[model samples]
Target: MTDPIYAIPDIHGQDALLDEALERVARDGGPQATIVFLGDLVDRGPDSRAVIERLMQGQAEGRPWRVLRGNHDQMLLDFLDRSVIHSPRVASGLSWLNPRLGGAETLASYGVTAPDPEAAHAEARAAVPQAHRDWLARLPLWHEAGPLLFVHAGLRPGVALDRQDPDDLMWIRAGFLDHAEPHPWLVVHGHTALDHPAHFGTRIDLDGGAGFGRPLWPAVFEGRGCWLLTDSGREPLTPAE
Candidate 1:
C-alpha cells in the first residue's frame, strides 16, 4: 500500500480513544504513515496528560506526525504563554467551555488541581511548561501534501492558499467556507464540528467533535482521496467538582 497520510481530529483528552484510533490507523495504513493532528488534545477527556506525553514521544522518535493548532490548542498555549488575557471573552467563554469540555481532566492527569475554579484556571494556565509553550507557538498554520491543504480551520474562500493568514487558518469558518467564491485547494480541517464528516466541494471537515461526546475522527488519505477511520464511541471525562 502507498504510504498514506492519516489525519486525526479533536482528541479532547480522550487518550484511550486516541490510542485506539492511532492503533487502527497504524494497522490500516502501516508504520510508514504520516500523521497530522487537527489539535484540541486537551480538555473534557480522561487522559490529556497521557495524550500530550505520547505526542511528544512520537515527535521525539521522529514519527511522521505533525500538528495544526486548533482554537482550543491556541487558547491553551496562550493561557501558558501569556500571563493574562485582556479579552474578557477568552477569560470567560473560552475558559469555562474548555474545562466543561475537558481542560480540568487534562489538569487532573498531571496530578494537580486548583483549590478553586479560579485557582484551577490559573493552575492550568501555569501548568504548560515553557518547552511545550515554545513547541506549540511554533506549530504551522497549514500542512500541504499534493492536493490536500490541512489546517485547524479551513482557509477563507477566495483567499489563495499562499495568502491565508496564520491566525485565520487556526480560526475561521463563515469567511473560510463562503462557498460563493471558489477556493484554490481542497481544504481539510477540524474546527467546526459536524454531525458527520462530509465534503463540500474542495473542503472535507473531519471534526466529528469528540468533546461533544462524539467520535474521534481519523482520516486516511490515499491516492488523492480521504476516508475516515473513527472510534465513534463515547468516552466520558471526570465530572467537574
Candidate 2:
C-alpha cells in the first residue's frame, strides 16, 4: 500500500495553527507519512518567518515534505527581484509590498519595520536569510502523486499540464474555478478562499480562509478518497455531495 499523504492548505503565516495541523497529521498518519504543503506559506498573519523557518528545519532534517509555490509566495519573490514590478503582468502602479496584499506583514515577520515601502523592501531583502529565499525560489509549482496533481491553485481546463502557464498555476482563479469539466488528474489546490474545503469530485480546494481568520484545513488522501483531519479524528470530506 502507498504511504498516506497529508495535504496541508495555505498557512498564511499562522505557525501555531500549522503546528497543530502537523501534530494532528503525525498522530493520525504517523511519522513516516508524506506531507505536502499547498503553499501560501507567507503573508497576512503574524510569523511568516516562523512558518518558513520551521519548514526549512523540517527540510534540513530530511522529513517527507513537499512545498509548492503560491501566488503570495511568488509576490515576495517578485518584490525581491524588483524587475518584475514593471512587467505587464502586474498592475501598472500597484505595489506587491502593500499591506493589502500582505507583503508588509511578511516583511514585518522578518523583523523589518520601515515607515515606507522602499525602506521596508530594503530591510526585508536584507533581513531575509539567503537560505530561506533560495528555498522559496526553488519551490515547485506543482507536485504529482499517482492520479492526483497537487498545485497551489487550480489548473486551466483543457490545457496540457506541461503547457500550462506558470502564472496561471499560481494565480489563476475564475477561469480555473468556473470550469465544470474534469482534467486528466484530480487537482488538489489551495488558493481560492472558502469557509471549508470545497471538494468538487474532480477538484479539491483546501484553502479555508486561514489567511483571513479561519482554521487551516489539513487533509489526508489515500487511494481514491480524501479525509479531513480534525481533533476528533479523520472525517471523510464530501463537500460536493
**Which numbered prediction scores highest in lDDT against the true structure?**
2
What lDDT tens digits, residue by residue, belong to model 1 across residues 185-221?
A: 5677888888877767667788887877787767787
Report lDDT per candidate.
Answer: 0.71, 0.86
Model 2, which residues run further than 4 Å from truth?
Answer: 83-94
The deviation in Å at residue 47 for candidate 2 is 0.6
Candidate 2: tens digits of C-alpha lDDT, residues 137-203: 9999999999889999878898888899999999888788888887888889998899988788789
Q: How close is candidate 1 to the true structure, as a TM-score?
A: 0.82
lDDT score of residue 168 within candidate 1: 75
Global Cα lDDT for candidate 1: 0.71
Error of 2 at 130 (Å): 1.0
Q: Highest TM-score, which number?
A: 2
